[model samples]
Every structure is written in C-alpha cells, then in structure tokens.
Target chain A: MSMLKITDLNVYYGSIHAVKGVSFEVEEGEIVTLIGANGAGKSTTLNTVAGLLRPRSGSIEFEGKSLVGVPAHKMVSRGIALCPEGRRIFQDMTVRENLEMGAFTRTEEESLEMRKRVYESFPRLKERRTQAGGTLSGGEQQMLAMGRALMSKPKLMMLDEPSMGLAPILVQEIFDIIKELNAQGTTILLVEQNASMALSIANRAYVLETGRVSMSGDANELLHDERVRKAYLGG
Target chain B: MGFLTNLINGVSLGSVYAIIALGYTMVYGIAKMLNFAHGDVIMVGGYICFVCMNNLGLPVAVAILLSIVGCTCLGMVVERAAYKPLREAPSLAVLITAIGVSYFLQNSALLIWGADPKVFKSVVDLPSLKFFEGQLVVGPINIVTALTCVLIMVSLTLFTSRTKMGKAMRACSEDKGAAQLMGINVNTTISMVFAIGSGLAAIAGVLLCSTYPTLMPTTGSLPGIKAFTAAVIGGIGSIPGAALGGVLLGIIEIFAKAYIGTQLADAIVFGVLIVMLLIRPAGLLGKEIHEKV
Candidate 1:
C-alpha cells in the first residue's frame, strides 16, 4: 500500500471547483512533484491532502486509514505534515517556539529529540533560535518553515512553493536540503512553479492545469517531453 | 509620609488590577478576542462568594474556591455561545456580541444579588503591620492580594512556558489555523483560555472585595476599565507586560491622588496613555511584525 493516496478528490471554494476529481499517490521515501501555474488548483490539492480543506468529494487514504473527516492536527499525529505556502511561520513567536509548536502533539522527550534533529538539519536556525521568525530573511524563514514541519517527525511531508520569493542561490540550497531530507528517508510531496528544479529532484511527477492532472509519469520522462519542454521547462 | 503610604497603596492596588488584567491578556492572546464580558464575570464571582458565605453558611475559603469554579464555567459558556459562533465573523459583530454578553451578565447578577452592596469579610486573620515610622502600614488584605496575584501569575507563566497545554495555547495565539492543523483542538484551547482568564478575574474580585468590602451590580466596570488600560499599556497580548502595566497604572493612580489630588489621577493616566501611544504603538513589550505584500 502507498503511504498516501488520493482517489477522485474534488474540492470547492464556495461555487468554484478548485480541485476537480484529482487523484495521486506517494509511496514511502520518494519525491513526488506537482507542477503547475498559478490558479492551476495546485495549492488546493495540497491543502486538501493536508486536511486543511474538507474535500467536497473524494477519498484520501494515508497508510490505509481514510482521512476525509479527520482534522488537520490529527493528520500531523498520523505522521503527515504540511509546510504551507508563504512560509507561514508564526511571526510573533521565536524560531524555536514556532518549531516547538509543530511537535505539540508528541510527548515531551520525543519532541525535544525532534527539535534537536531539526536544529541539526538547519544550524542557522539553531543560531537564530531565539530570534522572532519574522526577523529572519526570506531564505532563513523558508528553512524555519521546513525545520518546523520536520519537527513533527512525520512519515510523509508536503511542501507548497518552497522556493517562492528566494534568491537563485538560496533556491539551489533549498532544493539541495529537500533532496538531503528525502534521502534521509522522509517521503516528500512538493508543489512548485519551478517545474525544472522540481522535476530534477522528483522521482515521479505530475503536471496540473486548471483543477485537473494534465500529465503524469517519470520525472525525467516528463522533463524530456516536447510539450513539457516548451510550456514548463522553458526550452 | 504621604508619598510612602501612597506607594504601598499603589503596589497593593496594582496587584489587584494585575489579577484582573490577566483575563484580558490570556483571552486576547489565545482567541484574539477582547472579551468585554470579563468585567461582569468578576462581579458575578464576587456575588457567588457572597452568597456562598452569607446564604449557604460556607466558610470563606470554600466560598472563594466555589466562586472561582463558577466563574471559570461562566467564562467557558460565554466563549462557546457568545464568541464561538462568530469566530469567523467580522470584528464589529464580535465586539457587539461582547458588549451584549457583558450587559446580559450584569443584569443577571442584579436580578440574583439585588441592588445591594455586600461587604466581604477578611480571610486573612491578622492585623495591619506598620513600616517606616507608621507611615506605611501593610494590611492583611493588601498582603494577601499581592501574594495571591503573584502566585496566580507565577503558575500562569509556568503553564504557558513549561506545560504542553500552555504551549498549545501559545500556538493558538500565534496562529489559530496552524495550531488546529497540528491537531490541537482549537475550541477546547479557546475554552481553556477563557476559563483561566475569567478565573483570574474572579480572584481579583475576591481580593478587591476583601479590601474595599463592597459589591454592586457594576462593581467590575471601574476595575475592568483600569485592567483594559493596563493591558494596552503593557502590550495587549503580552502576559508579563500586563502585570507591569497594572503595577505602573496602580502606582500612578496612587501618587497622583496623594500628591496632586484624586481629580488629577484620571487625567494623568490618560496623559500617560497618550505618551505611550505616541512612543510605541505596540505597547511597551510588544514587538511589531510586518507582513510582506
């Protein structure tokens, strides 16, 4: 069984159909990228999977347990965490406090261990542990967001626009960190507008457009495809 | 002689205001709700203690405990019924709901306790102690009030900083949606915030009643206003800030009344507020975070 699976997931924002019967799955310890333009329902799909939005119709099964009505916090306890878009770190809280909040569901000792692990992954965060999250630079804030999500000690992690608003150098570093995290046995589900970068690291990838999965296959295969080259890869 | 006595008086009075201010800070921190009904909750607490002592022949300690419990439940109910439904509603609606709830509680207390003011007997079985050549006398009520406020504040600080539930509350304060995503029950956390805040308010009420020995339908209004001012003065969502603001306000009130006269105290308080607003809009302890567009 896959670590995470979505079957005919449909979501709505009042009258607008934001995710129309989308389906995908992530096996354990693999990177899956969902590439799309703005308004392609990329965020909606991620939000639904994270249990932030209740899907209007569809089934989300994580490790064989249905997640249709399960709340977002319960999803975290089930070893799934969402590093939401825009790096929504708690602005008023210190970096350490924001990270601590991620492990709020776990026991004290485990959470402390997780915090140590997160700090190890981003040593810069350790240095700025006492600094308010809002005070960090854009790249640092992104690292904080990822570090915070990892503090949950999840089996599957979903990231939305990890490279948005970052410098090119920081973007490469961020992607490198993502790969390192994935290599360390964390299953990843990423949504990105940077199709080239996402496809480069992703083991498998899907192309989404206007609330539907327009294409899916091996990341390398999609990268070489003619239509994908022009529309996504900037070839 | 007058200055020293006033200083002591201010610190004691400040302690009472600090107790009341905790409710405002806690509720505002977690739920981001101003909770205008908090003052009335204090009044309700006093009435409960009074009834338990006078009508039911309960001991003062039991009456205080029962009153705290009752006020905690009252705070919870207000959060659920008055604020929960309007969680996503506009600020105006919630503000109006708060006012309505405050009025409803005040009227209910009037109906139950009548329009009479009742004196609360001192729980501390000791006389006043004098300091500085009889200029400063430390009364039992004042000492008790300060001690109780410090105890509650310390526990509250420990709860927020060290305990799991307290961290959850802080998370909710920082970001409600994200806290909910972390599997913390948002509603339950909110209820806990209200309970703690209102419970503190009840303590303040009991303390004030012991000192002033008076209870009326609108007993909580003046103290409530003072506490709200303190919350703003110290930074609304900062816990330690509220306590500092309360103490500062208390001292100012005492000295202004002692040196200048009681009439000048209100003017001086507002003047200080204006200066604070001009200097730091976020209050003394609050750090501002700007959003990137």
Candidate 2:
C-alpha cells in the first residue's frame, strides 16, 4: 500500500515550469529513489513533495491525507521531513542544537527520547554535540543530516542528493545509512545523482528528465534496462 | 560628584539605547535586513501611549500595556505588508521599502500628533535612593530604568538560549532555506523577530519619554541612528554584542562631553566607529563568512 502519492504535480518558479506534471508514490517502509542529472527537477520534485514549494497545480497525498497547500512546519507535524540538498546545517549552531531543532514541533518527552535515539544512531554526533555543525567533516555532516531528520520521527523521509560532493567511501557510508534507516521501517523517498548507489539501495526507482518522469520500474529492472543503462547508469 | 552623576546619566541613557539596539540586532540577525522603519515604530508606540495616558486620561499601566500590544500588532503588519512580499526579493529592495515605511510612519505621526513636543508623565513618583552620604543618589526612575533594562536583557538571553522558537530563530538567521526544510515557519519566525524587536524598542520609547518628560514625532530617529551605530559596533547580528556596544558608546559620549568639550563629543563618537570598522570589519562580535568557492 502506498504511504505517499503524487499526481500530476506541477511546480513553477515564476514562469519556469520546474516540475511538469510529475507523479510517483512510495509504499510504506519502502526505499524509493528518483535519479536524474543536474536541473532535471529532481530536487524540485522532492521540495514540492516536502511542501517547501507549494505546487502550482496537482495533488500530494501522504497516507490518504492531501498534503497540498500545507506549510512546511505543518508537514513535519504530519510525519514528513526533508534532508535538503547541500547539507544546509546551521553553521553557528552546535551539533546538539541542530538535532534539537529537528524535534522543534515534538513534545518535550518525545524530543528527549528522540535525541537519545539520534545519539545512538550517530555516536559521532554525541561526541561532537558541543561543536558547531560547520566544523564537522563531510562524512560527519551527512550523518548529522540523517540523524537530524531521524530526530523528527517522520514516517516518510525525503533525502536530496545525500551522496553529492562526498568521498567514495563516505558515499558508501551514506548509502549504507539509507539502507539501515529503511531496515528500521522508515519510508524513504531519495533523490540522487548517483544512479548506481541509489538503485543498489532502492526497492524502486524513477528516471526524471527535464521536469518529467521518463521511465520508472523495480530497481533491479531499471538498473538492467538498456536506455536507463546508457543514459543514467553510465553504460 | 560630577563624575558619579555623569556615570549614572550615561548608564541610564545607555540602557535605553541598548534596548533599542536589541531591536536592530534581532531583526538583522534573523532577516539579514535592517528594518529602517523599526525606530519609527517605537515613536508610534510612544505617541499612542502618550495619547492613551495624557489625552484619554487612561491609567499609566493600562496605557503602557496597550502601547506594547499596539506596537506588536503594528510590527506584524509591517512584516506582512512590507517585508513578507520582499522575502525572496533583493536585499536592497527590502531595505528601500523599510526606509520608505520609516518615512511614512514618521510623517503620519507628524500629521496626526503634530510637530509640537509632548510631555510623557512619569508612571510612578518615588524619591531618590541615596548612597555614600548622598555622593551617590539614584532616583526611582533611574533605578526602574536600569533594573527594567537588566531584566529585559536577561529574559531576552534566556529566550534566545532556552526556548524552541528562539532556537528556530537562531537557526533561521544562520540559514533561512535550511530552516524552512527543517520544518520551521521561516515567515512566522521572521515576523516574531520583528515583533520582539519592536516591543523592546517600544519599552525604550516609554522609558525615554518618562525620563525626559517630552517627546517629538522624530525623537526616535537620532537615537535610532546612534543605536544602529551601537549595533554595528558590537556586531550587527549579535545581541550581547549590541548591549556591550551600546553601553560603551554611551560611556564614550558622556566622557567626551565631560572631559573633552561637548562640541567634540559627536565627532569623537563617530570617529570611534571609523576606527573600529577599520580594525574589525565584522564589527566587534559579528562572524566573518568565507566564500564556498
């Protein structure tokens, strides 16, 4: 059963139709990936789903409730969180403060428990809890991003380009973290440029090209498909 | 005797400036845009409170509370009408709009309240408290002003450090887009910052009126400029920095008037800004941001 659904979603940036009638869905506890090169509306699609960008038209439903017109803060309250691209952590804030901010809408009791769970997931965050988030290494920041999202206790987590600009080893570590997060029953909607790693971890994948979904299928089939092979998989 | 008296005067005046400066700092911290109209909002608050107490014969406490609420709502209106539309626009455009709003508020006050100076009667009448054989005497007004400033400062610190909204404001200041993605209502946070900052300025206006007993429509403008200088001195986006900067600027101005002739005081105060900026471009506490590329 689908936990998240998007239908004919159109988002515009003042006459620039960024996402043109794009649609997809993520089943509960499933890892779904959206793969595209730069400017393919991958990030735009994720942002629209996260309610950061109000759709120009179309519907976004999370667990049968329409998420359209809901503000970003309301989205978090209703169990949706986005780890946006560029790892935009609060630079002046301490590591602990960054995580605490994720639980901004939660009750005090839930926040405390969530903090402990986040610390356990990323022990390095615990070690550097006092340090400013900007001071963390690239790999540490990616972990911090994932941990911060986990603090919100969102049922559907959207990660945008988590592997971008990281070393190969750190990229593998981030992918492994995504898999682990899914294993723990969190529904994932990931947008990535790394098709190989994304498809490897994803249960299903969509191929976006120039503001529309060009193709989509089970992860293994798309990984083996001829067109997806030449265009995205670097065959 | 003169030295002690001047010190008291400096601190009292500085406390007022510090309150106003906090408004500038808070707005700049979160929005990264100077709400040029912020000082005029204080003037509006003062005029409203003055009319409430003096014109309508309302009780002083009631008048003050209404003025605060009035200022808060006015601030939210400014955010909604002026700042909100320009959120994604260029910084310069928002700044120009802020200046335009400031001018509009001041002129409207001038037309409504007139250009004449009006007296702001003291809310409470208590005799001075003396210390050291009367060498050091603090009046009830001065004591209240100092204590109120300290109390507000402490509360502001606690709010920024301990509260969830405060944390979100700080995060938004650091990176607005990221804060939005984190589920913070960036628009609401910015509006809250404007309200809190304007509220602080309103308190300062009331306190200033009480101390001086007279207020003009444009009274908040000069102090606003001086407070802006204080904000720049301590750091544009730093709260503790603004307070420290304000007190230091006040002391310097006082001493310049006392020891160095009043004529040179203004020159010296401005000269200090030039020297400080040359030495530390980021102001006293503002962090210097590095280019990613």
Tens-digit lDDT track of model 2 for B1-293: 88988888778877877888889999999999998888887788788889999889998899888888889889989999998999889999999999999999999999998999988787667888888899888767877777887888788889988899999999999888778767788989999998998888888888878787778889888778888888899988888888878878888888889999999988888898899999997888878768888
* Global local distance difference test of model 2: 0.88
Instruction: Report iRMS values in order.
Output: 1.4, 1.2
Residue range A65-89, candidate 1, lDDT tens digits: 9989887778888999999898888
Worst 10 residues of 2 chain B by lDDT: B138-147
Predicted candidate 2 versus true structure: per-residue lDDT over A1-235, tens digit per residue: 5799899999998899999999999999899999988999999988888777889999988999999888777788899999989888887889989999988888889889998998887888999999999999988998898888888899989999999899999899889888998899899999999998999999999999999999999999999999988998789
Task: For model 2, give the RMSD to the true fold.
Answer: 2.2
> Which pairs clash inside model 2?
none
Model 1 chain B — which ten-residue stretch has the worst lDDT?
B284-293
Indicate the worst ten consecutive residues by lDDT in candidate 1 chain A: A87-96
Candidate 2 residue spans exceeding 4 A from truth? B56-59, B129-138
lDDT of 2 at B55: 89
